[model samples]
Target chain A: MKKLIAVLTVLLIASALVFAGGNGESSGSGKKVVKIGVYEPASGDNGAGGKQETLGIQYANAITPTVTINGTEYEVQLVIVDNESSNDKAVTAASELVSKGVSLVLGSYGSGVSIAAADTFASAEVPAIGVTCTNPQVTLGNDWYYRICFLDPFQGTVLANYAKDTFGAKKAYALAKLGDDYSVGLCNYFIKAFEALGGQVIYETFPEGTSDFAAYVTNAKNGGCDVFYSPVSIEAAALIIEQANTQGLPMPILAGDTWDSNVVLAAAKGTNVSISVTTFFVEGSTDKQITDFVDGFKGYLASNATALTNNGGNDEIAAVTAMGFDAYYVALEALKKAGSTKGADIQKILPGVTYKGVSGDIAFDKNGDAVRNVAYVKKVDNATGKWQFVSVQSVK
Target chain B: MGFLQTNLPYLLAGISTGGQYALIAIGYTMVYGILRLINFAHGDVFMCAALMVIYSASYMPLYISLPLAIVATGVLGFAIERVAYKPLRTAPRMSAMISAIGMSYLIQNLALYVTGGLTKYYPPVPFISDSIEIFGAMTKRVTIITPFVTLVLIVVLVNIIKYTKIGIAMRAVSRDFETAQLMGVKINSVISATFVIGSLLAAIGSTLFFSNYTGVTPTVGGMPGLKAFVAAVFGGIGSIPGAVIGAFIIGICENIIKGLGWTTFSDAFTFVLLIVVLMFMPTGLFGEKATDKV
Candidate 1:
C-alpha cells in the first residue's frame, strides 16, 4: 500500500511538471496577452444581474478578440472572478484581479459591492470601469473607478420626469430597499426630483430578505399616490408587483434601470399595473451599430444556450448587458489610446476615451462617471407582458 | 373598526408567517428533545427540501412532486443521521453538535454546487397561492390555511406521540436514553424515526414558506431556520406547544414593528426576546429542569 501511494504521488508530480511545461511552450509561441479582469457576482443576491452583465462582456470579447497598441497586436484575455455579490468578498475578488496583473477591470452589477472594492482597486493601481453600478459614491472618491453607465441622479431624474410628464402624476410614492446603496441612492434622487417638480413624495423602505409586500402595497393604495416608484432588487420587485396586482392598485409603477429585467417582466405579466423603467439601451433600435450588435448577440445566444440561460433564458437584450458590452469596448479603446497595459497609463487616457458603443456614445466626466444624459424609457405592455419602447428622455 | 381594518392585514400576515415558523421550530424542538443536542443541520435540511421541490416541480406536478420531495427530504435526514451523528452517538455530546454544524455547511455547499448559486423561481400552486379577501384585508389563501394546517398537524403529532407504541418508545428514549435501551427498545430505529418525523415537518414547512416567498436562493433557509431555532429556544427547547406560541409572538411582534416603520429592529428584537427569556427563565417557558447525575 505504501509503495502504491508513493507511485501515485510520483505520477501526479510528473503530470504537473508536464502540464506546466506545455503551458510555457504554448504561451511562448505567439502574441502578447493582456488581461482585462471581470469582477462580477456570479452568486449571491446580485447573481442574476451579474451573470447577464458577464454575458455582454463575453459577447464583446468574442467580437473583438484582440486590440492594437502602438501598432502591435495583443490578445485580450478576460480574467473573470466571482465577487459573490458581497462587500467582504468583493475586496478579495478585487485583489485577485490585481494579482492577475490585469490592464483594466470591468464589472460589478451592484453598487454596494463596487464601492467596497473601490479602495482595493485604487491601492492596486488598477482601473475598474463599472458596467451598471449607478450609485454616485462608487466613482465619487475612487479615482481608480470609472463607469460606462449614467449615475443614479440622472436616471432618477429621468424616471421622475417620465412619471410627471407621461402619466401627469402629482403624488408619487417611492419604495426602496434598505441598506442597498443602489436602491437607496436612486430612490433619494427620485424623491428630490419629484419634490422639485412640486409633486408630493411618500417614501417607504423594506429591509433585505423581505419576501412580503402586501402591507406596503396597501399603504401605497391608501395614500392615493398617482405613481409608485420602487428601485429595488429583482426579487423584491417581483413580490411588489404580485402583491400590488392582487390588491387591485390602479397607479402606474415606475423604477430605475435595475427593474429592466426579464424576471421583473415575468412577474408583472397579466397584472393590472402598467410598469415602466428608465434603462440604458432599448432593443429594436434603428441605429446600424445597435441593430448589428443585437443580431450578432441573438446569433451568439442561438449557438450558446448557456449564455441564453444566464440571460433569463431568452433573446431579450438586457440593458445591463448592453452597458457591459460598452464598458469592455471603452476599456479596449482606453488601452489602445494609452499604448500600454499599465494601469496608470489606462487611467490617464480613460477620461478622453470615447466609443460609440452598442448602447450609446460612452465618455466620462471629471468624476469618472459616464457623461451621457439619454435614458431609454421602456414600458411593459399589460396586454402582452412584453417590453415596448416608449421614448428616450434626456436629463440635464 | 377603522383601526382594526388598517391592522387586520398585518395581523393576518403575522399569523401566516408564524405558522410557517412553528412548523419548522417543531423539527428543532423534537430533535433537541430526543438527542439533547441542537441539530444545526435542521435548517439546511429545510433548504434541501425546497431545492428538491424546485428541481422536481419542473418535471412533475406539485401533487406528485410535493410528496416525492417530502419523502426524499426525509430520507436525506435519515441518511445524515446515519452518516454524521450515529457514529458520534457514544462520544461526547459536543462532538455530535460540531458534526451537526459541519453537516449543515456540507449540505449548503452541496446545494450551492447543484444550483450553481442561482435563485430559482418557486412555481406557484394554483389553489393555495390564490388570494382571498378577509374583512377588507386581501391575502393569499395559503395565509389563512397555514395556521389551521399547523394546528391540525400538531394535534395529530401529539396523538401519535401519546398513543402509538413507537411514540411511547420515543418518549421513553427522550426521558432516559440508557434506561430505554435497557428496557429492550431499539435505539437506532427510534432515533431514525425521530429524524424522519422532523424532516417531514421541515419539508411541509418549506413548501408553505416558499409558496409565499416565491423565490428559492441557496441561503433562503438560513434566516427562517435561525428564527425557527430561536422560536424553539424561546418556547422551551423540548416543548412543541411552547415553540408554536413563541413563533406566533415573534412573528406578530416583528410584523407590527415593521408596519410601524422599524424594519431594522424587527429582526434584532427576536434575539432580544431570546436573551430576555434566557435571563428570566433559563430553562425556557416549557423546558423541564434537568438535574445531571454527578
Candidate 2:
C-alpha cells in the first residue's frame, strides 16, 4: 500500500512536470523557421493586458507568417513564454526564450518584468522589442531592450497636463501599488509633473494582493482632491473603479497607459465615475493602417474563443495589443535589416531599424527608446462601453 | 459627526472584510479543534467556491449556480479530507499538515491551469452587490449584510456543536480522538461533518467577499487564508467565537491603519498581532491550558 502511494505521488509529479513543459517544440516544416521569442506575462496581475498584447503579436504573425532575410524566405514562428508578471519569474522566462534560439524577441507588457529580464536578454545578446512597457528604466542603460511605447515620464506628464488643463484641478490624489515598478514609477512622474504645474498632489501606495480599495478611495474623496489618478494593474484598476463608483467619488479618475483596457471600460461602464487615460492608439480610428489592423484583429479574435476570452471576451482593441502588433512588425524589420538570425547582428541593426506601424512611426533613438512625443488621451464613454479619443497631447 | 464621517468608511469596510475573514476563520478553528491539524487548504476551498460560482453562473441561473457551487465546495471539502487527511489519520501529525500544505498548492495550481492565470471577474450577485449609502459613506449592500450573516451562521454552527448528537460526537472526538473512537463515536463522520460545515461558511464568505473585491485570481485565497489562519490562532485555535472576534479585530485594525495612510503595514499588522499573541498568550484568548496526564 505504501509503495502504491509512493508510485502514485511520483506519477502525479511526473505528469505535472510534463504538463508544465507545455508546447515548446518547433514546427517540422520544409521552410526555414526563424523563431521570435514572446516573453510576456499570461497570468498574474498584468495577465489581462499581457494576453491582449500577445494576441496582437499572434494576429500580426497570422497576417505576416513569413519574412524574407537575404532573399531567403523563413517561416516566422513565435516562441511565447509567460513571465507570470513577476520580476523573479522573468529571468527564467527570458532564459527560456534565449535557450529556444530565437532570433529576436518582442513583448512584456509590464515594465517590471521587461526590466527584470533586461539583464538576461543583454547577457544572451538577444534584442528585445518591448510592446507596451513604458517605464524609462526598461531601456535606460540596457542596449538589448527596445520599447515601442512612450516612457512613463512622457505618459505621466501628458496625463498631468490633461488633468490640470481639462479638469481645472488644484489638488490631485494619486494611488499606486507598492513595489510595482510600472505603477510606482508612473505615479512618481505624474506627481512631479502635477506639482510642477503648481497643483497639490497627495500620493499613496497600497500593498499587492489588496482586494479592498475602499480605504484608499475614501482617502481620495476625503482629501478633497479634484482628480484621482491610480496607474495600477488591470486587476487592481477594476476593484478601484468599483470602489470609486460605490463611494460616489466626485473627481474624475486619471491613469497612464495601463488603464486603457477593455477591463477598465467594463468596470466603469454604465457607472457615474469618470475615467481617462493616455495611450498609444484608440480603436475606432479612421487612419487606414489602424482601421485595417482593427478589422483584421477583430476578425482574428472572433474565430478563436480562447483569444477572444483572453481579450476580455470582446474584440475591443487595447492600445497594448496595437503596440504588440507594431512590436512584431518592428522585430521583423530588424531581422530584415540585419538579414541574419544572429542575436548580435539583430542587436547591432535594431538601432537603425524603423517602421511605420499602425500605432505610429516607430524609430529607435540612441537610448533604444521610441523617438516619439505625442500620446492620444482617451476617455471611457460610460454609456457606450468604448474609448472616446479626447485629444492628442505632447510634452513641451 | 466629522470624525465619524472620516473614519466610518474604513470601519465599515473593516467590519465587512472582518466578517468575511470570520467565515473562513471558523473553518480553520473547527478543523484544528477536531483534527489538531491546520487545514491550510481551507482558504483555497474558499477560493474554489468563488471560482465555482464564476464558472457555473456562465451556464446556469445565478440562484441555482450559487447553491450548486456551495454544495460542490462542501463536497470538495469532504473529498479533500477523505483523500488527503483521512489516510494519514494514524500517521504522525506533521504528515497530515504537510499533506494539507500540499493540497493547498495543488488546488491553487489546478485553479491556475483552469483559469490559465487570468484574473476572472466575479459575476455580481444581485441585491447584495448593489451600491448603497450608509451615514454619508458608500459601500456595497453586501458590506452591511456580512457581519449579520457571519453572526447567524456562527450561532447555528455553535448550536449544532452544542446540541446535536453528531455535535456531541464531534465535541467528544475533539476532546479525545482515540477515546471517542473507542466509545463508538464514529470519528470519521464527525470529521467529515466538521469539514462540510466549515466549507459551507467559507462558500458563503466567498460570496460576500468577492462581491466587494470582485477580481478573483488563482492565488487570491493565499492572503485571506493566511489572515484567517492568524485569526484562528489569535482567538484560540479551538474556539469558534474567539476566531470570529479575532477576525473582526484584525479586519478593523488593518483597515484603520490603511485609512491612516499606512497601507503597506496593513498586511504586516496581522502577522505582528500573531507574534504578539503567541508571545504573551500562547494558547490564545479562550484556549484551554494544556495539561499533561502523566
Candidate 3:
C-alpha cells in the first residue's frame, strides 16, 4: 500500500511539472496573438552580445505591443530561446522556435549561430531576420534567412583599409579562433583584403576555450608586425585586450563587427591598448531616429537591473542592440505587409519589406541581405571609456 | 639571446600557469591519497570559489570577502562529501565516483543558473594584477608571485603531514581504511579534514589563476580541472610533490608549444604526455609499486 502511494505521488508531481510549461497558442485576453521567435544566445561565447540584442527587441515590443494587420488588432508575443552560441545548440534552438509555431523570427548576435540555424529555418519555411550576424553565408543560399547588418566582406575590407591608410601599417598579424565560423571567416576576409592592399599578412588560429593569449600577442609583437588584427568573439576579445595591454603592444589592434560592444569597451578601458572596429551604428548619433533610440533604450536599460547587467553592467548602448531594435520593427513591417501570421506568408513578403531603422534604411537585395554599403568606424578612448567616431567607411 | 628574448614570455606564462595547475593538482592528489576516488567536483569547487569571490566582493571589501569566500568553499567541499559520498560509504567504489561526477554537473548547472550564463569578470587584485618587467619581457606580477605562493603552501602542507596528529591519522586511514577505523582513528573527521585542505588549496589556486586570466565563466574550470587531473596521474595520483613537478612540466611545455605557433596542439600534447607516461611508468614517477595480495 505504501509503495502504491509513493508511485502515485511521483507520477502526480511529474505530471504537474509537465503541465507547468503552458502552451503559447491561447491568449487569456481574447485577442489574436502573433508570436515572433527570438533566437539569441543568452549563455555562451556570444551571450553578452545576444542579451543586448534581445534587449532591443524587448524594448521595441514594450513600446509597440500590438500591430494592426488588415482591420484587426493582433497582439504580438515574443518567444525567446537561447542558442548558447554553439552550432549544435543553434539547430536545437531553431527547432524549438519552429515547434513554437512563430510567424517570423528575429535573432542571433553571432553569424556562426545564424548560419548554423539557417537550414532549420529553411526547412521549416520560417523567415529569420538577422540582427548583427555579419557573415555573408548567413543569407547566401538560404532563402529563409534575411539579415539587416552589412556582410563581413565589406566590414573586413574597411578595417583592412583603415589599417593601411590610417595607421600606415605594412605588416599585419591576424589571429582568430579555430572552428568559430565568425572569427575564422572574418579573419580570412581581412587577410585577403590586407594582402590586396600591398601589405604583408601573417595569420594564426587559436583553439577554442583559450584563455591564454600571451604567446599570441608575443608572437605578433615579436614578428615585427606594424598592426594586429583579431576579429574574435567578445569573450576572447576581452582576454586578448588584457594581454595586449600587459605586453605593451606598440601597434594598434583591429577587429570586425563583433568588437563593437560595450563589453569590449569595458575591457579596453583604463588600459593603454588601442582598439578600432567597424560596426553598424554608433551611440550618440546626430540622426533623430538614432537619438530617439539611444534615449529610449538608455531609459529602458536603466529601468531593469537584469537588462543593465546583460548590457555589461552599464547603460552604454551597443550597436547590436540598435540592430536588434531595428530587426524587431522590420519583423513588424513584414507582418503588416504580408497581412498574415503564417511563416510561409511572412517568408513570401520579407524580401519586399523595407523599414527605416535606427541603424539605417533597410532593404534586402536578391540574396536576402541588406543593401548596405557604408560602415561606421569607431575607436575606443581608453581615458574616458567611450567610443570616438573615426570615420564613415565605404568600399567603391 | 635573440631566441631567449622571443620565447621568454611564453616560458613565463607557462610557469605561472603551471603554478596555478599545481595548486589544483594538489587538491586532486591529496583527495585521491585518502579516498582513492577522483573527486571530479574539485574543479567545480574551484569555480565556486571564484564565483563566491566575484559576487561577495561586490558587497563587501576584498580583504574580508576573499578569505570568507575561501572558507565558504571549504564548507561547500565538506558539505559535498557528507551529502554525496558519506551515504554511499558501503556501496561500490564506482557509485561514489559516479556521485562525484554528478556533483560536478550539479554545481556547474547551479552556477550557470545564478550567473544567467553570462561571463562574470573577475575583479582585479591590486598588486598581483599590476604589470611588471621580467628580463625585458612584460607580464603580470602574479606570474612572479604564483610560483612562490605555491611553493610556500606546499611546504606548509608537507610539514603538517609530517608533524601533525590529524595528518598522521589521515595517512593511516589512506594506507589502510579498515585498520585505521578499527584502531579508532575517527575516519570521518580525517576524511573531512582531507576535503577541507584540498578545497582550501583549490580556492587559493583559483585566486592566483583568475588574477591573471580575469574572466570567470561557469565552465571555466573544466579545462584546468582536466589538465590538473592529468597532472595528478602523470605524477602518481597519491604523491603531492610529484603532482607539482608534473604540473610545472605540462604547463611549460604547453606554453612553449603555443610559442612555436602550434596552439592547436598544446591541449592535445597534455594527453599525449599522459599516454606515454602510463605506458612507460605505470606507477608514475613517485608512485609506490603495488604488490598483489594472496
Scored by lDDT, the top model is: 2
**What residue runs in model 1 are displaced by over 4 Å at the alpha carbon?**
A1-29
Better of 1 and 2 by DockQ: 2
Q: What tens-digit string does per-residue lDDT give for candidate 3 at B1-294? A: 777778899999999999999999999998888888899999999999999999999999999999999999999989999999999889988999999999999999999999999888888988999999877899999998999999999999999998999989988988999999999999999999999999999999999989889888888889899899889889988999999999999899999998887877888999898999899987677876766352
Task: Report lDDT (Cα) of residue A392, candidate 3.
Answer: 94
A1-396: candidate 3 lDDT, tens digit per residue: 999999999999988855653465558898888899999999988888899889989999999999988878899999999999999889999988887788889989998899999999999889999998888999988899999999988888888889988999999999988898888888888889989999998888887777888989998988899999999988888999999999899999998888888889999999999999998888776888888889988898889887888888888888888899999999999999999888898898888999998998999999999999999999999999989999998875
For each candidate, the DockQ is 0.50, 0.80, 0.79
Tens digit of per-residue lDDT, candidate 2, span A73-182: 98999989999999998999998888777888898989999999999899989889988899999999989998888899998999899989999999999999989999
User: Which scores higher on TM-score, 1 or 2?
Assistant: 2
In order, candidate lDDTs are 0.86, 0.91, 0.90
Candidate 3 lDDT (Cα, 0 to 1)? 0.90
Task: Name the regions of candidate 3 deviating beyond 4 angstroms.
Answer: A1-26, B290-294
Model 1 chain B: weakest 10-residue lDDT segment is B257-266
Instruction: Name every residue pair that clashes in candidate 3.
Output: none
Q: Rank order by TM-score, top first?
A: 3, 2, 1
